[model samples]
Target chain A: MARLFKPRMLALAVLAALASRAHAEPAAAPARAEVLHWWTSGGESAAARTLADAFRAAGGTWIDTAVAGSEQARAVAVSRVAGGNPPTAALFNASRQFRDLVDQGQLTALDDVARQGGWDRVMPPAILDAVRVNGHVYAAPVDIHMTAWIWYSKAAFKKAGIAAEPRSVEELFQALDRLRAAGLIPLAHGGQPWQDSIVFRAVLASVGGRDLYLRVFRDRDPRAIESPEFRQVLLTFRRLHGYVDAGSPGRHWNDATGLLVAGRAGVQIMGDWVRAEFSAARQRAGVDYGCLPGLGEHAPYVIQADAFVFPKNRDAATARTQALLATTVTSPAVQVSFSSRKGSLPVRSDVELPSPDPCVALAAALMRDRARQLPNDEMFLTPDQAGAMADVLTAYWNRDMPVETVQKKVVAALRDDL
Target chain B: MRATWAARAALVPVALTALLGYLGSTLWTAQMSVTASRTLPSDHFVGMAQYVRLFSNERWLLSLDNLLLYGVLFISACLLAGSVLAILVDREIAARGWLRQIFLYPYAMSFIATGAVWQWILNPTDGIQAVGRALGFSAFRFDWIVDPDRVLLTIVIATAWQASGFVMAILLAGLSGVDPDLWRAARIDGIPTWRVYTSIVLPQLGYAFATALVLLLTGVVKLYDAVVAMTQGGPGTASEVPTKFIMDHLYGRANLGLASAGAIVLLVTVLALLAPFLYARTRAAASIA
Candidate 1:
């Protein structure tokens, strides 16, 4: 009982200290920051270390709190903020994910840091717009992750007798068919709902093209969803279902990546972060494996970013640390190093690639073209709408649901946005 | 077992905990179900909209069906296997103590570790089927782990493997208390052993079976960990249960309104199913008294 009571007393003491700090007098305290994020993977951990190291160099003490999954991490962060023990910084995707939190005045905007770093000019429009909610920067953008990259095993491609990267959707399917004929698993896919949504979005961008894809996702246009083009995309997505093995269902994305890693499967449509897996397996990009960002020239570069948001904290010392940490993380030195390890492009366009991987270099070049910049579904859809849309895609993937029904459901899912 | 002042005082903490933790949250959930809450609770009430949306959802519907299939199959299989194991040990079988310990061993382990191991063993491509082929039994197949139509049964198998031993332990205690004279009289009458056990011993084990049944039922309703560890309610929502659906909405989708609504519906269902059983139990007790 004494042992138990001791921990409870200590917890209460900490809570009391935090409570008093919420109304603490302005004092010149040492810079200390508590950062909460969902970046527990090996590559992500190293990326976090870069930021931590940078903050330490910038005269701040960095405290790291990493949760394994985004949903759980965000929940913990939000609860902490609500419970009056908000961390100095919490990581959120550069999307409408934090819109309500900002509305409730729970976030500290980093407009000063944004101006100091010239974020307006360097950041891509999609990411810039995401962080700059209501003309104030609510998050410090770290890295840009492209969502529509098609990764392939070079060995599998060789066995399939493929000569070069397919430049068009038709050619891409032809390559998949060749891989299928070679008696290898053509598409190594995890059948989780999110994974299903990834495949669907990849198909939407590659097969449906830029305008159709943007209209359905960004505009939530009902007519666009009902269009023949969207129908074709849906059909194409359903057709790829036949390419995966029986073990694809309920499999993790990393396990699916392992199929490519082992040369047992040909291709996987996933984010740029797959580079970490290749790196771990000692498979050099453009040699052991290859990446195609999209179908062709007409395809837009789909951008998803991870950013840090400061929780509402009035303590002078904590606010100072938050500012220091935000500025340090977005600085070119930190962004370049962090993004490289994180398998994402630096948020800053100014940073020159140092030891750039092949796929990342291609994505960076594509990201430079303003017209080709498109945000992922999360940026456009509320988390609710995105989840509903995922359900529609997953249902279609797992069942013999007709393409027409899927089209109607997709429109209904975006009805709130409409 | 007398209710004393110290015992009554002791009940204070448990009572307070139950009132605040269970009843308080349940009321809050009921209130939230009527609101248009996104990530957090809000006061703006939109009555029944969430409930309506929940029913309209294909994923929710599929989860309910999976839960029903899983519940019926999991409980029955556990009861059957548990009873069989108990009876086998009861007959003074060879290495009875060792066999009893082996049967109860799975109960001591956690579902998380067990489920993950089961996932690997049941994985079709490189797990059981691959092993079978390697051992020259290429015709052997157990791809139900990935099959959409049959995935819930795989959940049943994995959960039963963990839960059956628990049931066996309960039944064994009930078997021990059975009258020795009933067995001796049955032996004199030349009744078959299976008939004697079923007609005599099984009827007397009703109280024990009820206790086991109630526990197993609760397990079925709160079935989250096994599904999460084993299948994550996927292969595209094929194995999603109501708890997973509610959790996904409550956190992942940030639709607490829908999640609360789901909770309400699930609660009503459990009550509806339990009311008759509870009423019948009271009636039986009243008649005896």
Candidate 2:
């Protein structure tokens, strides 16, 4: 009886020690941060690690609560704030996504950090407009992504006997025709609505030029939407549908990128994030693939960005950590490293990038020219209006809806907008 | 008299839960439906404009139609399959425990994983269609998962696979309670086993079937996971359902007003449909007593 009791007492003592050690350090806990973001993929995780490393180096304890999808991440953040257990900072798109949170006084402003970082002068106008609400900056811009970049396979182009990149919409179509004639799928497109809209925007800007694109989306001008020029752009977008493969519907964007990686497809109109896919397959930019920003003159470069907004917290440690995170994220050195891993351009134009990334170099050069800078659909339209318009466009793309009907539908969708 | 006090004490929890959890949420949802709430709840009332928008939206209309189709097919298939499996188990088959576990495997899986597996199996290029073609049947086509007209049927198949197992388990519980004397009496009357099951057994299991049907109906109403995992309400909103529409509006679309309106509509429709059935249940029990 004595022998058995002694061993049980020993086990109980071990458990007590473990429990006490776990509970001993609550008062001494460092500037603790619980960041919530949707960066679960391998490359995305690597990019996030850059930020985590920066935060840790600044004497903050990093706690990552990475959710996989953007909507799920935002939902978790919303529930946390509403339940009075908010995270230190939450990732939001550099759009009006967090406008509701700001309006409800659920987000902490970063005016001090923004002023110190000189964000107004360094950040581009479209990005500045996204992060600033009223008079104060509410979020820190991390990286800038250009949607609707034309990515093409160099091997596929060579096989199709095309010598150079297409300079105009007509040339691009002719190149697609050549790829088709060479017995290849000319467009490696995923049939989801967002991807569909990306392809449509690419055509809208590159084909119809910048002003026409803005009038339809930014101004929500009904007359421009129903105009002959916009109709022509719509028809051009329809023509690309013929070049896509039959099994394109319900395919993931990565699988569509796989087609280009394998050189079985010619062109994929996608965001700069596809560069990560190319890199994953060990494909170089200029040698293995090529990126076209837009059709030469009068082209508009649409920008999208990712940022982190702090949940409203008066805790001294949380405030300190949030300020540190803002500085780390916006710093030129960290932005360069994070953006490189993220497969996008740095938000600051002054950030030095390696020359190997020809695509980002081109985007940065276009970024310097304010005339070519355009906001993506998310930057201008609210998420609801954007989703509604995307539904109509996706339906029109998949179904046999007439262009005139689509024009009318766009008008109806924007009828209630401010 | 003391036992009466104890019984009354037990009613307090039920009463509070019904008032605060159920009734409170329903009222909140109804209020929000009238207001132009976006992302967060607001007091800016816009009357029935949200409902007006909901009715006019083509996507919402498609969602309702899809839900109706999916509900009918999923319920019928699950009941038919469950009844058949329950009968097989009731016959005292060999290795009954193993068979029961195997049949219940899909019910234990999360719908997200099962939906993904079904998506892979039904995907035209890499799934069964490709395998069939590779085996020299070049004309094979199993593209219903992508086709707008037939996508909902594929959802029915995937959901039925997950739900029928659960129905079978419930019916088996009911089957176990059948008095063995009834079988002996039927045998003495020279009644066939199948006829005995159809006539004597099925009628007794009515309550179990009703329970399973109610559970399955709730699942059909909140059919977000299977649709999102399998097709994401694509290709071009082909397989959209009411819950998915509400979720998209609530989160991705940031239109809480429209989503709340949709939720209220769904809840009212379900309650209205269940009212008669519930009334009949209570009346039948009263008559029996």
Candidate 3:
């Protein structure tokens, strides 16, 4: 009891000292931005560090609070704002996340920065629309990620007697069968909800075509969901489930990529971030692994962007920090450098990528075609609806649930979202 | 008066802490639950709408069901295993101190590391399956973590392994405080060992059992880290718990309205389960007085 009591007393004393000393760092005159973000992974950390380094170099002190996952970092930021201790700026995805923040008057408007930078001319309209809440910019776009990309192991393909990339879904499945016949796991799936949705969206685009994809996810049309086109998409999504191994359930996304890296798996339907894992393994791109934008020639390229939002702060010093952050995150040189390490395309349309990763170049080329651009579910639907739809999709994929039943649940979830 | 002043000063910190940390957060969460908050809290009031959604969510409902199953199994297993281990250790066994340390060591390590180790150990391809095949047990299968129906059981097993030691330590302390004279008298009366234990010794452990139960119950209510680190509430959310459900919406889903409702529901559930027992204890105490 004495030992426990003594430690508790010490802890209390230390906490009391810290509590009194909170936010009393001799308020610097220049903008001192405290940024909370989820870029703690090696590549992501490097990307964030470059941004911070630039911010510091440009007459500011960059205080970085690094958390691991996007979900966790966002939660901390939101809670901090509620608790009346909001950070200067925090990283957020380019989705509907900032809508609620803006509704609560928690985020500061960045219209001044947008005008100063002439963001209207450079940033894509879709990208601009995602950040703008009621005709005002709430976030600064950092990087863009293309979600519907298929990564394959060259060694696994060679072993399976696949000479080149498959242009269509039929040939893709045929290649998967050949890989499985060669005694390799065909689809390296993580089995998490997000990864499951990614593969489903891939199939929806490649098999069901672009209009049907948009109608089901974006429009949430009941007829579209019940149509034969959507049913084929669901069937194709479920068909890929057969190629995945039993151990794929509840597996981490990185571990699934590990199978590909080890040549134990043939293909992974993942985002551009898989390139980071391949690079980390010291494997040269195009030699060790190959990336396909979509299964077919004219498939829509699904895209998601990561961005940062500045929460509204009354303090002048904190406001200055927010303005600096908005300016620093969107600078062209910073965008290209940060996106290069992150395996994502820069949000700015004009910036040229330096990395010669054939996969990234193909994605860049596809991204240039405005007609091929597709929004992820989050870009169109509320986070709640997307999550609910993901739950239904995962349940359908995991079990032998009837497609008709899934369609009903999808409609029900969308109705609930309203 | 001076002593009283010192006592009041000592309690000032605790009172302030309880008010600011516990009560304040509770009120804040309760207030937020009634509002139409989403990714962030809004001032607009939308009474019970979030609760309606919470109840409608299949994952939240499944998590609530899993929590009940996990709570029952985990608390019972820990209590039984702890009591048995305490009794065994209390005997004139060789190297008793070493054995006690071995049993209690798991409690010293964080559950994050332990959960990962257990996940690897229970994984089919890399763990027991490989070893089983290596040992010529070709037909052996120990992949409970991947089996949807059996995944919760795996969580229970892993959690019980890490927690039973703490229970053993508590029960051992209680067992040591038992009157040695009672045991000597029982032996002289020629009473059977099993009977002596069940009738006399077990009854003396009621207070210790209560303490262990409360500790384990608290653990059951907040069982997020182990489940996350091990299964991530998956194999299709089979091992999902209410705390994980609340946390997922609180952050990942960015649906605080639903998260707040889940938190309130969880709190009410814990209070409802604990109230009757607490009331009974108070009544018993009053009657004895």
lDDT of 3 by residue, A142-229 (tens): 8888887899999999999999899998889999999999999999998887888999888888888888888987798999998877
Model 3: residues >4 Å from true position, as ranges? A1-27, A115-118, A315-325, A416-418, B1-9, B185-192
Chain A TM-scores of each predicted structure, in the order given, are: 0.92, 0.91, 0.92
* Candidate 3: tens digits of C-alpha lDDT, residues B1-289: 9999999999998999999998898888888888877777666798888888788888888988999999999998898888788887878468778878999998889777898899899988888987998899999999888888899888889889888888999988898899989989999999997788778997899988888988899899988888877877777667878887777676667777778888989999889878877998999999999
User: Which residue pairs come into collision in candidate 2?
Assistant: none
What is the C-alpha lDDT profile of model 1 across A163-252, one tens digit per residue? 998888788789899999999999999888888888888888888878997899889999999999999999999998988998888777
Error of 1 at A108 (Å): 1.1
Score every model by TM-score: 0.94, 0.90, 0.91
Q: Pick the candidate with the highest TM-score.
A: 1
Given candidate 2, what's the lDDT at residue B193? 94
Please give the lDDT score for candidate 3.
0.82
Rank list by TM-score: 1, 3, 2
Q: Where is model 2 more than 4 Å wrong at Cα?
A: A1-33, A56-61, A316-321, B1-15, B88-92, B172-208
Report the backbone clash tally of model 2. Answer: 0
Q: What is the Å distance of residue A283 in model 1 from its true position?
A: 1.6
